[model samples]
Target: MLTNNIIFYSDESSIKISVNKDLFNKMYQYCDKSYPNETGGILIGTYLDKQTAEIVAVIGPSEDSKTWKTRFNRGAKGINKLLKEYWEQGIYYLGEWHFHPNGSPYPSNIDTDTLTSISNNSKYSCPEPILIIISGSHNCYNQKSYLYSSTGQKFEMNC
Candidate 1:
């Protein structure tokens, strides 16, 4: 079933995230295909307000990336082109999504580091970036989403 916009809050920040049933199904399928290895991609969506974002699409991993049972390195290949195309269509780069094979859907140290880098990097342009972690076996999957603000605060959102 499709989820309505869900609001999650931290002491310093809050955000709203939503995923349609179709998009969820597609992400699940992609995660399943990468079973026993980690996979990830960028999240495309629009901001509803200063603190809220609506996730409309989840792009799959780049073909140049490396995936292993414990790690996933998202390569920078064709992403700029895709981002340009999406920007032309009025969709902005909201955040990222990744799967953790046989693990919990919580952010790891590396995940937090990556999010921090994204928030601090001038190239990203987004002051607050979302991170969605999908974890489970091939038969089932779960998600844990977080929002990281430029101030270095991270909030775990309900999914």
Candidate 2:
């Protein structure tokens, strides 16, 4: 588990991501609540610069979302409303986060495809999106962060 805020940089140094300890704990709690079933939510934060983002908040799984042992289909329920509220606080939608339960933090093919779709979707209004995948149990957890571009490029963020 993460005890402090961490910073990650892409291999190309094109982007930087910062995740705080509180947010990490919150994601852990959400993952714990779902247990064997996969669960996920949206990430909300602001850009510190053209290439840097600091994750400040996370919205957990929606009521309409579908969660299976190996797959999670995030629903759109209440997300627009939540995004509007967060926008008032200057917290824009940064990307998404999910738990893999006993699996690796690395993203699967579906994840990559979904992220690419999100990047191209104007409804999201984010040309590039970030993804955070958390895996493992309460005692020992792992996390991987990725950035996806509208051009179908994926960048893995490194510590």
The TM-score measured for candidate 1 stands at 0.89
The candidate that wins on lDDT is 2
The alpha-carbon lDDT assigned to residue 84 of candidate 2 equals 91
Best by TM-score: 2
Model 1 bad stretches (over 4 Å): 1-12
Clashing pairs in 1: none
Each candidate's lDDT (Cα)?
0.81, 0.90
Report per-prediction Cα RMSD to one decimal.
Answer: 2.1, 2.2
Q: Report the alpha-carbon TM-score of model 2 versus the true structure.
A: 0.94
Tens digit of per-residue lDDT, candidate 2, span 57-145: 98899999999988999999999999999889889998999999999999999999999999999888888899999999877889999
lDDT of 1 by residue, 60-154 (tens): 99899899999999987999898889888888888888999889998988988888888888776767888988899876888888888776678
Lowest summed lDDT over 10 consecutive residues: which window, candidate 2?
1-10
Error of 1 at 86 (Å): 1.1
TM-score of each: 0.89, 0.94
